[model samples]
Target: MQGKRSNQIVQNTAFLYFRMLLSMGIGLYASRIVLEVLGVEDFGVFNVVGGVVSMLTFLNNSLSSASQRFLTFELGKNNIMELSKVFNISVSIHLAIAGLVVLLAETVGLWFLYHKLSIPPERFDAALWVYHFCVLTAFFGILQAPYIAMIISREEMSLFAYISILETVLRLLIVYLLKVIMFDKLSLYGILTFSVSFFIFLLYWQLCRKRFVETRIKHFIWDRKRYIQILSFSGWVLNGNLAVVGYTQGVNILLNIFFGPAVNAARGIAFQLQNAVNNFSYNFQKAMNPQITKSYASGDMGLMHRLVFVSSKVTFFLTLIPCIPILIETNFFLEKWLGKFPDHTISFVRISVLITIISALSYSMIVSIHSTGTIKKFQLWEANILLMIVPISYFLLKKGGTPEVAYWTTLVLMIIAQSARVVIVSKAIDFKLYTYFNEVILRILLGLPLCLILPYWVFVNMNEGWSRLIILVVVVCISVGLSFYFLVCSKSEQRILNKVGFGFVAKFQALISRYSLNK
Candidate 1:
């Protein structure tokens, strides 16, 4: 059973990796094209305005996890009937939430976009147009949640990856369309983004309605109890999600008020690079999350503990891979990737990457806590900690601190929040705090010294050029690989890595042998 779970994780990760690569390629390309076409101020305008409306996403994200957890839990029990009920109730809740959001977006969200945001007077109309369609995109995305959650709960990663690739292709098309269309580029981009979102949601809907037995709308049955259960679970989940919104959208607003749209442009560039780097670990986590949840449902605390620890370690390495080179050469990377940098972009990217590293360690732990379905104290404390970023940064900037002050605030808060995560999760599970610190956290800390040596050497010796960039990447690759292999990984992990390597080679040899024999 353990081996089967491991194989499933491996297969899921294999699919997600393909998704990541396609997304990275298409995302990097699309961003460059979009940035160039929209120019600096307009690009910033889109991000900031869109960001305000995105605050509505706090509900969307919270319910996604709530829905996926209940669905996966029911499937683990082999209760298809209950699963269908859960699906219907989740959709009902989401539809209700979507309506509420539209009401708010038209009233409160619209007012904030116009009155509170620091959008330029000239581009106000473009920003307003973007806001209207973004509301549509956000609404449809919420309604699309149950199908997406169902797909993920079934561990149908290939379907998920394929849908993502399609979305990537559509985004590429949008960028292409952005160039030739004679209308306002910003508004066109906004409308096209909504159209793409709606189309993708339809694709998910069609696939789920056909494939998943529980997705038949005609047979769907709703339950008030199930609604209450999911609501009870999600209500506690709301604090953490709202804090995330505050931490992100709130900070973006603060930046706009203080530093103007050009600063927001810089921030937009930083987030693109950050998200690109973050997608590596995110893909791995997506593959592992279901297993983590399922193990708990099966009363296998032992397997749950092991999966959480192993996943945390592997994904930390996944993040460190790209982060090392980028941190070593931020200016060079941004200048090459985007061909232009706004103010504070370099510092923002660096700080955000560092925060992502700390956050990666706590991700599996958080999933474990969620699986237990008792997270009120955990969410409240963590949310408060994260919520500090906005006001802290606000005060700092008011005192004349740099824009980087916000992310620095985030970095400090994340460290505190992560430590709190381990503590909170410890009370709910059998996790040994000492073991976590000794086994997982210690390895990462020990690896840092080794990881930094070569990158620092390259930084001091090399000049700013393509040659330097290439050499820096090579050095980071070699050093990080060696450190993770010799320093971070256990003997068992190293053996697993070796076996996978040898197995692939052996398969290739067997294939070649058969071909030669046929000849």
Candidate 2:
């Protein structure tokens, strides 16, 4: 059973990385094109205005979490009947949430965008267009939440990969159109992107209906008891998501007030980089998330514990591989990629990447806590710690702190929050704190410093230019690889790696033999 689960994780990870590489390549190129076309002012306008709408998406994120936990938990127990009911319930809740978000967007978010945000008056109409499409995009995302969760829970990662590729292609297509389209480029990008979103939503809906009976939206399967239970779970999730919205959008708003829209544009670009780097970890997490939930559901604490710790270390390394080099080359990379927008872009990217690494430490723990379905205390305290970033950032900004102070504050606060997450999850599962610290946290600390010494030395010595970047990449890869293999991976993991190595070699030889025979 463990082997089968491992195979499933391998398959999902392989598919996800395939999706990530293709999408990430196109996304990076498209981002450059979009930045050039939109220019700084318009880009910043779109980012800050869109942030208002994003603030209302807290419920969407929360409910997505709520629905996925329930659906995946039901599937783990092999309760298809309950799964279908959960699907219906999730749909009803999401649609209602979508409506609520729309209402909030139209009234509160709209007012905040126009009156509160530091937007220039001339581009107001363009901002309005962007806001309309952003709300449309939000609704599509809300409605499609369950299908995405359903696909992942079913472990149909390849299918998800195909859909992701389609989305990526559409995004690339939008970038192409931005150059050719005669209308207002900003508004056109907004409307066309939302059109793509609408198309993707319909595609997911059709796919889910055909593939899963649970998604069919049959006769009213409403149960007040179950509804209350889901609400009870999702309510705390709402608080947590609100915290995310508060720190993210709230900080954006504060920055707009303090620094203006150009700074927001820089932050937007930084977030794009953040997404690209974090994908390496999150995609891996997505593959293992269901297994964590399913194991806990089946009372397989041993597997759950292993998944938790191993995923923490592995996901951290995944982020580290790309991040350390980027951190070292932030100025060159950002200047090369985005062509100098504002003051804080490089600092933002560096700190954001570093924060992503810190956040990776707690990703699996968040999954473990959520899987246990006992997230009230966890989410409450975590949210409190997380939400404090906004006020702390605000206080600093008001005191004339640099924009880097915002992210520095975020990193420090998140480390605290993430530590809290580990504590909560460990206690929830009654996992050994000493074992986690020794096997996961200490192992990573031991490996990383030793690993960085050689890489950082090489980076410091290398002359400027492509040679330096190439050498940095090689040094980072080799140092991290050897350090992780020797110090981080468990004996079981070492065995697994060796088996996989030999298995691949054997398969390659057999394929060569068969080809020769055919010849």
Candidate 3:
């Protein structure tokens, strides 16, 4: 059973990584085209305005998290009937949340877009178009969440990957249309973007209805007891999700107020790159998260602890690989990719990459805590720590700090927040803090210097070009691989790696020999 579970994880990770590669390639290219088509100011306008809509969707995030946890937890217990009820309840709750969001967005969000953000007089109309479209997009996205959660909890990662690829291709087509279409580009972009969301939502809804019996909502469920239970869990999660929205979208608004639309363009580009790179860790975590939750639900505390430890270390290493080259060669990559990026884009990308590496370490801990369903103290303290970024960033920008100061503040607060999670998770799960430190943190510290040394040296010694970038990436891969094998990996893990490595080589040899015989 353990072996089967491990194989499932490996297979799912492979599917997700394939999805990530194609999606990342198309996404990076699509972003370049969008920037070229929109230009910096209009791009910034869309980013900040769209950010307002995102801020209002925090409830959706909260509910989505709760739904995933409960669905997966029920599956762990082999409770099929309860799973169906949970799915129905989740769908009903999301519909209500969707209506609430629309109300809030049209009222509070629209007002903020008009009065609070720093848009030019002429572009305000376009920004307003973007705002309304964004709200519509968020509406569909909210409705889509329960289906997505159902798919994930079912471990239908292949379907998830295929749907994701389809969405990316559709978005890429939108970029192409933006380039050729002669309509008001910004407004047209907004309309097309919402169209994509609505279409994707339909796809998920239909797929889930066909694929899973639980997702066929025969009628809306209003189980008052279950409603309170799910809402009570989501209420605490709402605090953490709000803090996330505050630091991310809230800080975007602050940037608009302080530095205007051009700076927002820079920050937006940075995040596009960050999101692409973040998939390296996120895909891995997605594959592991269900297992973590299910294990806890099944009372397999040992397996749950092992998954958390392995996932935490592995996510950090996965994140660090791309980050090293990107940090060292941000200018080269950005210049090559964007051709004419806005001011502060390079600095923002570099700092955001560092922030991603730090944040990667906490994904496992977050999932583990959620799995236990005792997140009130965890969420409360974590929210307090993360929520500090907005006010501190506001004070700094008010005192004339540079645009990058917001990102820097985020980086620092992220570190503090991750430390807080370690402590909270320790208490919540009776996780051994010292064991985590010795196994995960200490090994990371030891292995990181080795991973950086070769990449930085190659980067400094060589001239900047495709050749240099290729060499730097190769050197970093080799460095990180060796360091992880020699230092970071446990003896048992090393043996497993050896087995996989040798097995691959043997398969390659056999394939080559068969090809030679055929020739």
What's the lDDT of the predicted structure labeled candidate 3? 0.91
Distance from true location, Cα of 453 in model 2, Å:
2.1
Off by over 4 Å in 3: 499-519
Compared with the true structure, all predictions reach lDDT values of 0.87, 0.88, 0.91
lDDT of 1: 0.87
| Tens-digit lDDT track of model 3 for 40-95 | 99999999888988999999999999999999999999999999999999999999
Off by more than 4 A, model 1: 499-519
Best by lDDT: 3
Candidate 3 TM-score, C-alpha based: 0.97
Model 1 — which ten-residue stretch has the worst lDDT?
Answer: 1-10
Looking at model 3, residue 234 earns an lDDT score of 98
Across 212-316, the per-residue lDDT of candidate 1 in tens digits comes to: 978877744567677778998898889898888877889888999999999998888888778888888878888888888888888989888878888888888
Per-prediction TM-score to the true structure, in the order listed: 0.96, 0.97, 0.97
Q: Rank candidates by lDDT, best first.
A: 3, 2, 1
